[model samples]
Target chain A: MTTMAERTRTTSGAPGGTRTLTLGKAVNEGLRAAMRRDDKVMLMGEDIGPLGGVFRVTDGLQAEFGEQRVVDTPLAESGIVGTAVGLAMRGYRPVCEIQFDGFVFPAFNQITTQLAKMHNRTRGAVELPVVIRIPYGGGIGAVEHHSESPEALFAHTAGLRVVSPSTPQDAYTMIQEAIACPDPVLFFEPKGRYWAKGEVDLDAEIGSSTLDAARVVRAGTDVTLVAYGPSVETALKTADALAQEGRSAEVIDLRAVSPMDTATVVTSVRRTGRCVVVHEAPVFFGAGAEIAARVTEECFYALEAPVLRVGGFHTPYPVAKHEHDYLPSVDRVLDAVDRAFAH
Target chain B: MTTTNGSNEAIPTLQLLDPEGRRVTTRGTKGYRDRAATLTAEDLRGMYRDMVLTRRFDDEATSLQRQGELALYAPSRGQEAAQVGSAYALRPRDFVFPSYREHGVLQVRGIDTVDRLRFFRGSDHGGWNPYEHNAQVYTVVIGAHALHAVGYAMGVQRDGTPLDAHDGTAVITYFGDGATSQGDVNEAMVYATVNQAPVVFFLQNNQWAISEPTTRQTRTPLYRRGEAFGMPSLRVDGNDVLAVYAATQEALERARRGEGPSFIEAFTYRMGAHTTSDDPTRYRTTDQEEVWRRRDPIDRLAALLRAEKELDDDYVAEVQQSADELGVRLRAGVRALDGGAPVSTFDDVYATPHGVVASERAWYEAYEAGDPPADQYAIAETAQGGAR
Candidate 1:
């Protein structure tokens, strides 16, 4: 694995210069840029101020901005979100950081019942332009609650736009877009990919149109592999292995889960006729299940076989030693792809 | 004034007017009484009128629910002084976050009568624009908006709204004694005190949460919970309009001065059932009801006005006429309310265009138009766009 410092080389032409940054640093820069752009944009979370958050995703923000802008809040998830709702009502955009995925349950009511429904409940007269950033997914060898993918629970609720970034560049741009968005957004950061380095264009403007749509990361015709967040990297690796096996595979990165770009998946599946949905969430009633149902509905006659899924089983995220088998890996994704072709 | 709890310990409570409607100013009530003294007879009469109108509105809403015009109704009968007085203390620019049962507060805040009934009528979740009246839509989930109030106050502080001036803005959130048990409420106090956010937590300790008594919510006096958070906390007679008004004024002033959040536990009672759906008879006794009936907020305020020579038979008749007119308007407006088109349900669910909502809306529209499932899918596909 390349160290983050080894990836920190900069290109010379652009104003700020295109630089390779870890996903976490990219998000920090994104937040920094957003704060500079709008004084109303503020950061609130536990240890988000002086300590710069546990993951250091918010490092140096409080030093640059004042304590008022980068608030270090009490250790309460519901308080973070609920108060953010108030701030949004008062015309401030508050970006809340939930330290881990599993801990988000404490604020589940605020997110789903209040933050998600405030706008609709008020007939669009009120806009809660708040962003909740949750570091999600496994692979760092952490304990139980620290490593889990709970994206499906939020995506199932209406009045919220749930999105995840698979690459450092996407993380950089999407964070800013999520802040500028007029609706409340749940931004699930793939913690496993925090140190995964990629070149990010520092001067790039946010393209709002692509923020909620799926993108075809790799194109092929033999079969289609759908994945998001951490699993996107796995899907890409699976596609590479398929190519070596003399099989062509298409890879779709589902950036947004709630307002899923299903049409893109449908269009791709029409040509490929084979689909495998992948994620780290439990397969039962997960985001993959929704994608599979939509794909089967749209491309029923065109599909060579039924839509297949590769994901965590319907059980608690197992201990670190067993997480390898529990999480959907390249091998699991490849196996599902091969099964798609078996029919 | 003081009352003994189950433990027989004396608990001080502020009351400007006793149950008999005569002025009573003990050491605990002196400062608050002085604040109430600032109001003229006209101001007192105005407060009385608001309480009367609010009670009349509650009665009408309750009757409407029984007539099947409304799906449910949460009466604000016994807690009129607590709601109206506290709301009266707020400046026009100061924001308010109220629970579902704050009909009197909504009335005092100038929320439209029809809009106030929309939630209970099931025509809309909340029909008023929060920014319009500097008041948020009614929050049904217990204690959730407490955090919002604190957060809004923090925003106000960041916005550089004056803290030491009378013009400085503040935020106040209303909840019941039952809300004290919620984690969000306690978390709100933690945030408010730590951030020193200019907010006031007005607790209408109406003595019950649906069927459960206040004892189930907390062992100590509810105001002590605020004291525990290290803020100025007080208990006031909820039936006395002057006392409630004085307490809220002091709390709001403390907040506007950037002194941080304050808590006021208005010791009131729920003269009516919690809501039209609730059966208070099952858990509470008629004897307890009889004890509180004599302490009705509206009647207490009337007696005060009568003693002060600010009210007469004609004035009472005039207020009653205004309430009767309001009842007529609410009935007409609610029945005439349109829930809007069925397809409009998909509207406003998001601020930006969402593919899922658009797709479902397209399918629904096609289904309504008698299109086949194939045609519906085609329309949905078109609605979501062919590709990114």
Candidate 2:
């Protein structure tokens, strides 16, 4: 399968003018584009209207779309998601925003039991194209219950498509794709990378195929580094550090976590014969573990060593002071890469 | 039993018919009585037919479970009026979100008998098309569908349908007394009232949620909980079919007029076990069950019809014959149901193709085809000797 980056390179002859946008603004623009494209698309969340969300990811949306479309629901997370299910049943595409990752437990039952299984439970008679956008991961030195990486919890559930965007371009296209898709998507916005800017072409057309495929952001042959969301940046930085040491590293950005694009990582690992998976969630039963297991099974003959993982320790996101040590850093990813090489 | 207001004034329960099946009106029930008086004998007989058929369905399902033909069955034997009466009041355009054990409503909605039992038969989670009857499949989780009903009402509000129009859509959701304590139910009431969504919360206070009594679920009347949310709320004799029908019709009409949601606490009793797997004998006294048995919903309705000369032995025999035919059909159809191929489990998981599901399905198919693994890692037969 061709990566999205490769598809973009091959398809774009004379693309629209590119503009630098923060990851948050890219998502905002993507939401706006989707709402404009379909009248059925509406956003529901607390403080998203007028307040533009805590991170300003949904800034100015309620103003552009009427209040009826961009609804500011009551201060109830389960209410937001549960009602969105109803709205979806009525032929509306609802995009809900959970304020923070830690606050998502209130809506966990609705998301998992209702939204995730509605279509399958109905035997495909009902299509709930609800996008639950959650600002996740620890960064910016936030308080307790504000910083968390709960992607694996959702990724483990069937009938849910979990995806995270590492760049503004992917965020811009993927959010729109997720809204258009008929399945319920848990769009985990990397809170740490909300302000990270990248050039996004406004006129670029993204196919649905690219929504679940991983991309080779930076290529090499010594070892493959697989990461997603906030940890993708860490993997790239680790590759740069490895380059200075004369050890090449291939960096892969796994956009979708649930229906993981394992084939791309497997291809890269088969060539490199070594692999390390990275994420900001705890190493115990994290998305990295799934990637590691898949890499080992598929690339067993090509493997020169066991696949390694770099992620959070098995503890609550520590106090703000110790978060840098708690989250996966470039150094930790490099250490995992070194371990893979040593093996 | 009477409820009290803040000033300690007694609030009478709404009742259009007494336990003896006599047409009697209380002060609070006069308006509802006038509404029920408008129904013709034909409509009354139709309701009687539905109630009798629903009870028969419940009995047949319980027998099926006893015979191991069904995995489980939740009987709707005593709450027939609470379910059938309210369902009779809905228009074709109105939607319904029913919790599990709403077999009476499903019957009124014309859900296939075999289709209704499929969930209990362990063949499928939901067995019927929701849109076909403007009713959703049974939601097993308590109080969750209340929010869905309110949300659907909100969607109706946005659809530009004239709220005052007779054809305008409304929504009704049914749950038990036990669900009133759930946070989702409270949250649903909050959303419903605040949005003024066109929905009705039909609570069947069947005296017991399994072994737990209504007292354990609430200190105040369940309708008072809806009043707390600022909706017009009332309590009714759930055994009285006319009372339930009148109350639900008024509420549905109010909803269509955009007056907002209303809550009705149908005071009834669960005369049978919660499910076939449950033993109600272990919890409640038989004396209490005997008291409710005298106030049976189907018996009261049948007596009321017989006294008014609207029902006779011929009509009763016809109804019995139809119910017997329905039971036979349910038994034959349910037993003949095929769960379909095992590989079909992977189908419809996602509307779009998914890589993980596809790969896993492929692996499963290969395994089913008896293909040997390239790298088989298995414990040797000798390892079984170490088992505890």
Candidate 3:
């Protein structure tokens, strides 16, 4: 098994004019740069101040920006997002953090109904440029609500842009870009890979890396493996393992979950002729489900086999001891790949 | 804290005028009475005219809905004073977040009656631009906009608008007793108080939320709920236009001065059913209706005007003529409103162009146009080459 540090080293292979940073640190630097660039950019969430957030993703931000800009709100998710709505109306870009994925439901009404529709309801007279950051997915075997992959819930909603970053570079750039976006953005940070290191170019044009564009991380001819967030790393590993065999596998990192960049996936699938979708979320009605359905529809003639999916079962995210069994492991992804080739 | 008199019984619903159209001045509301006295006869007359026009508009909308011109109508029949008075107290720069039944408030905030009709008429979600009149679109989901108002008020504070200078910038959020039960409203109050936001939570306790009474929503007086959240709150005679205006003006002043959020529970009643779809007789009795009918806000003001010799048969007839004209205009405008949905329903789903949305929109358009499956499946041209 490759350690996160070894995998990170392999992934972040960029040479000149780049810095090696863990995904968390890269995001911190990105937030600092965004706040420096725009005075209207502010942070609001629980434990984000002093404690530096439950995951410390916002470490040292309060000290740098002062208490006003990096506000530590009470334990109220709804209020945090709800107030962000008002602040946005008042011409401020508020970046709200939901400590965990499952906890976001408390503020779902505000996010879906208020923050999402304010633009169209006002006939574009008002723009809610708010960013809601949720740390999601499972790997370290956290308890129930903490490990849930609820991106599909957000993706189902209109008026919101849902994106997840796999590599540190994407995390560094995506957070800043999401903040700069004119519409509301639901940024899903892969907490399982928060410490994964990657090379990030600080001087690169910010928001130039199109978030909604799916990128082919690994190229091959035999099959296309589609994944996002935590599963992207797993899919990449599966692709590497498949390279040792006679089969050649390609990997696509779906950075944008909602408003999915399926065109890239379809193009890859057309050449590969076979594909497997992977994610830590429930396979039923998940982002992977949508990707599979989309691939079949768009690349129907191009596919040699039906698109297969590797994900968690429909049951609740299990306890720590059973997490690995529940989550989509590299073996399971490869099995799905082999099944695709069986046809 | 609760706005209680020395005896601490919660100052018996502050009122400047009785139901019988007589001035009943009390020590608790003396300050407001003084403020009301500053208004000339013309100003008072203007307020009366607005109330009458709003009622007329509400009646016309209700009729339109019944005639199938509108999809639905949320009536503000009895709570006109509560909405109009607070609305009139607002400065042009101040923003208002209203629950669905604030047709009168929309009128006071410069949104045309025709523009307000767009929502019910299904022509548009909200026809007027919020920036044009400093009023947000009507929020149908109860208590949701309360937090939005808090957030906006917090933004108002950060914009360095000089809160203490009375630069006419603040936020007012409207909701009913039922909405206070929602976590969003409570959370909004939490943020508003913590941020010291320049927001006034104008809760028109219209006694019933649809069919559920205020008692079902809260045990203590609605005003006391704010006290628990560390907000200074007062109960006002929502039927008394002068009292409602005075109370709202004071709250706005407090907010502008950076005194944090204030709660005003207007002790009003929903004279009509919750909406045109509801039948109040099934849930409420006629005796209750008769009791409230005697305290009609418009009639009380008219009585006061007649007693002061400021109103005559000629002036009454003129106001009725104006109301008739407004009704005619509303009827014509609503009937002429387009009932067809737009071809681009997917537009504005996101401010920026999204590939999936673009694809879906194309599919929908083709389907609506009765195109073949091959044509329907084709993806639309992706929106510009920009950051997604």
Candidate 4:
């Protein structure tokens, strides 16, 4: 029997079901779903209004909601989130797209100081319920200050929920849930994965990803392959390839980066006894490091072979083909799997 | 059309006083002495008090940073007047967004001074709720918070959120000269203008971006930079708390009246390093510092206070005592914060972790149940059960 989740992505534009949809499109669909259900939903970004966006993620949004709702903003990232603080004060749900990952740094103040911890900081007087969408990761091979996986930065902030989705389904569901929640959320969509295709059931409302939960993408008895965002697809491919080798690798998708769902991961690790974690960011202090450390601590006894990490080299995401090598690959996952088996 | 300081070079920018502390009024004989026409003396005196207290706090926080009580501190010594004046000018309902260094502005907004310290101390991200005092948290990043302010202002414009013109809410964001270089800063202006979001872009032009000078930041005047983005720009004397207060009030009122966005460049100087990690002497000279030193805002206000005898010696002593007490409180707060303290913070990953995080949590649980390595980071080297 074929379950609904077993279908391959045939119709695709972007994450929200298009072959050509950029990460920007997936985010647009997320915003649309959230806004359609709740009038309080609004998006603000630089060039996000009449101009669509520098990347055009917010194209035609203002027209749908009017200029007052979809704000174009004065090239002020800090102000965008800063005023989102105010809008949320008046009971409006603000979804701010930071345009680019590198650009998001400027608004880090608002995100870290204000948006990240508004609920707890205010003693629950203000429920930010704001979604800050940032196009992250390095695959476009753009210039300096373009491709970066600063998820660790956000994940390191308290009082803010951090989640990343690898598929259109997750994107659609999670974006809506983010708007519905009373806490602030940092929604990081891989700029490179925006064009990836996936099926979306418009009729079904995907509820919240457990505030902190991990999902097993593939069932396996040997090694648990863990990753999220763009890395999840890679891990999936790696798991499929591993299946051909008769090593049923369990794949875990880390939809939430912070307030990490260690419980689910530990259960998977305890079940598999072996694990290989992966991510696109550098290994030094990336999300992969935190996952590897915590998993080692939580799933310590369950492991037969040691836990290993497959991630980008400890260097700045280089240009062109170098970036391809820089990012973890199926071969890297297999190699980590080999190391785990040898142990 | 050719407005200048009656000079062939156009005076470069407007000025009510040079660094020499000499009164150099702009066009028309309204003069610096009569600058108070737009501001009340009592307001000016209150502004002075705010500046003094903010400076005291700023200095105390800086000490905490140097003493390892804080990870970093962006001291706004000279820019106090700019922040306090601009912030205090806003209506209670008006929203304020500030860069990391806006402690003075936070004080003006009734922010718990300890809250700012907690953030820098790394005790917790931010300790205050923006809505509690009608102010947003201090964004440590460059200028992105300005765009959020713009978006919120857009929300305000959409909700028909405000009925009365003067009573309507307005958005104000504070950032340093360095932040103007950020893409979000430029984009914020474009959006705010086209949408006509009732927002004010408060740029504190303190003439330095870390070691980078203001000259390297822009070829044109900072205020005029807003004009290119279709915003009306004003360059005001940042050191004069009265001027900052008056200019900010005017801009906020204009914003509330559907006047769109305005950029007010608070022409001030940064008396301290960008943060504790910075060394200003490497980029600027003592002589240059001396130039701004003569333009001491606090001294000028003190001069004005003395000239009018608005404050007696006893009152000044009481203010000093209050400042000292605040310093002790901050020191105590800083002393209480310890490093390597367990902390977990996620920026804003919007999604509530459902599967992936849950799996990791489960893995961590069982792993912890089994004894881990002697050293946490040495996971690979020290096997869980074997090492334990």
Per-model TM against the reference = 0.97, 0.95, 0.95, 0.68
Off by over 4 Å in 3: A1-17, B1-11, B339-341, B366-388
Error of 3 at B46 (Å): 0.9
lDDT of 2 at B76: 89
Task: Indicate the TM-score of model 2.
Answer: 0.95
Alpha carbon lDDT at B117, candidate 2: 92
Q: Tens digits of per-residue lDDT for model 2 on B1-388? A: 3643223556567888888889985665668888899888999899999999999999999999999989999998899999999999999899999999899999999999999998898888899889999999999888899999988998998897887737778899999999999989999998999899999999998978888887688777678898999999989888889989999999999999988999999988888999998988888899988988998988888888999999999999999999999999999999987778898898888877777677666666667889844532121111111210
RMSD over all Cα atoms, model 3: 5.3
For candidate 2, give the docking quality class from DockQ. Answer: acceptable
State what share of the real interface contacts each candidate retains.
Answer: 0.87, 0.68, 0.83, 0.35
The best candidate in terms of lDDT? 1
Shift in Å, residue A166, candidate 2: 0.5
Worst 10 residues of 1 chain A by lDDT: A1-10
Q: lDDT of model 2 at residue A82?
A: 92
Q: Candidate 3, residues A1-343: lDDT per residue as tens digits?
A: 1121221222221222689999988888778877876778899999999999988999998998998899999899999999999888878889999999999999998998888888888767778889999999888778779898999998998889999999988988788778878789999999999999989886655543486788899999999999999999999999889989978998999998987877788888989999899999899999988888888988899999999999989898999899999899999998998899899
Candidate 4 on A1-343: residue-level lDDT in tens? 1111221112222234323334456567767766665677788777888888776767777887876668766566776777687677667888888878888876777778767655654445556777888888877868876778888887877667788888876776677666676668888888788777776654344444343457888888888888988899899999889889998888899788876665567778889889888988777787877777777877777789877888877776677667777888899889999999988
Model 3 has a DockQ score of 0.60
Please report the candidate that would top DockQ against the real structure: 1
Write the number of the candidate with greater lDDT, choosing between 1 and 3: 1
Q: What share of the true interface contacts does candidate 4 keep?
A: 0.35
Against the correct fold, how does model 3 do in TM-score? 0.95
- Candidate 1 lDDT, tens digit per residue, B1-388? 8754434677888888888888886775678778899989988889889988998998899999999999999998899999999998999989999989998998889999999999888889988999899999989999999999999999999998877637889899999989999999999999999998999999998888999887787789888999999899998888888889999998898889988999998989989999999999899999989989988888888888898899999988999999999999999999987789999999999977888888888888878888746645577767877322
User: In model 4, where do residues sit more than 4 Å from their true spots?
Assistant: A1-31, A44-64, A70-92, A96-171, A181-206, A209-212, A216-343, B1-41, B51-81, B100-104, B112-127, B163-165, B182-184, B208-213, B270-388
